[model samples]
Target: MISDTAEYALRAVVWLVQTPDESQTTRQIAEGTRTPLDYQSKVLQLLAKSGITKSQRGTGGGIRLNVSPDGLTVLDVINAVDPIQRIHSCPLGLKEHGTCLCPMHRGLNDAVKTVEAAFKNTLVADLLKTRSKSVPLGIDLPLRAPRKPKQATA
Candidate 1:
């Protein structure tokens, strides 16, 4: 799973993408995205430092994206916020890890690679301009009811 920090950063980026001309205060991004204010501020700060976002500090001040949404890939956002180097490292730091995958660290690298590929391929602009190709969580199915069991070992 992607870090919650990355998820919040993407939400902030999407908010900026749709409102390219408006300076969204961190508070506004937090409230709009349902993220906690402190977390939003920290994420905003990281984005600012990374030059992905520009900040205005005085009256009527806030933040805005420096790059157009189309030019901003998910990798850009990922790097700007929660970097994934540790993700690629072996959990157990084993050398000679092979396709068989060390039992002590079975499939960990593959899991990280999957996340990297997903983030690398996605773009912030694509998020703003499109409907999700798959059903979003809490949308396609009932949220509260127990899932029905497979019938009779069909």
Candidate 2:
């Protein structure tokens, strides 16, 4: 499972990719991504620190993507906020066991690898193309009511 911060980071990145306009203020980014302004600001700062996004100050300045959406992977965004930690050593801390993991841990680590692979292969651009119109990035936006069919004149 990923952290809320990571989720917010991903949403913010995806929103930026989708918009691809001028730099956006923290408030705008938070509103577009449906994340809390306070928390989103922190997430944006972390992103800027990681070089995933660039932050500007003063007039005509805000935040924008530093890396191209096509070049940026989901893993990159996730790592910016909450890196997917891998099991490197035995949890039991057995000297004889050394760095080797038990069968259970081995399986868990393998699963982690699988997840990493999926994230690595997924790009923000790809997500934009395949995202559901019903719920973008799992954030449910207000849907418009269906229009009534027009009747033929007599």
Candidate 3:
């Protein structure tokens, strides 16, 4: 699973893709993605450092995606923030442990590989295109109706 920072980064990237030509300030990006501005700024810096996005300073300066959404994968954003670490060998570091892992660890490692491959293959543009129309990026408050209070019986 990805971290909160990764989630925020993905949201920011998707928001940028929605307006590909326009650069957005951290404040605007945070507001648009409903992410915390402070955390979002750090995530933005990581994205910039990873070369997934470009940043500028001073007036009219902002951040924008450096690559096309179609070419960028969800794994890119995740790696920029919290990389998915695949277990290549036995985690216990047993001296007698051979190249083959125990059934349990092997299955876990296989699952990780599967998830990694899925994320790596999923493009940001594809995510946007395949997202539910009413709840893009899984952020639609209106989809859930507010609970009604019950009146006390007399």
Best by lDDT: 2
lDDT of 1 by residue, 1-154 (tens): 6689988887787666555666778888888778999999999999989988888988877888777666678988987898876334455555765344564445665676787788788766665555555632212321121122237864
Q: Any runs in candidate 3 off by more than 4 Å, and if so which?
A: 138-154
Instruction: Supply the TM-score for candidate 1.
Output: 0.73
Q: For every model in order, what is the number of clashing pairs?
A: 0, 0, 0
Residue 5, model 1, lDDT: 91
lDDT of 2 at 119: 93
- Better structure of 1 and 3 per TM-score: 3
C-alpha-based local distance difference test score of model 3? 0.80
**Worst 10-residue stretch by lDDT in candidate 3?**
140-149
Candidate 2 lDDT over residue span 1-38, tens digit each = 87899999998987766545567899999998889999
Q: Give the whole-model CA lDDT for all candidates, comma-separated.
A: 0.71, 0.82, 0.80
Query: Measured by TM-score, how close is model 3 to the native structure?
Result: 0.83
How displaced is residue 27 in candidate 1, in Å? 1.2
Report how far off residue 111 is in candidate 2 (Å).
0.5
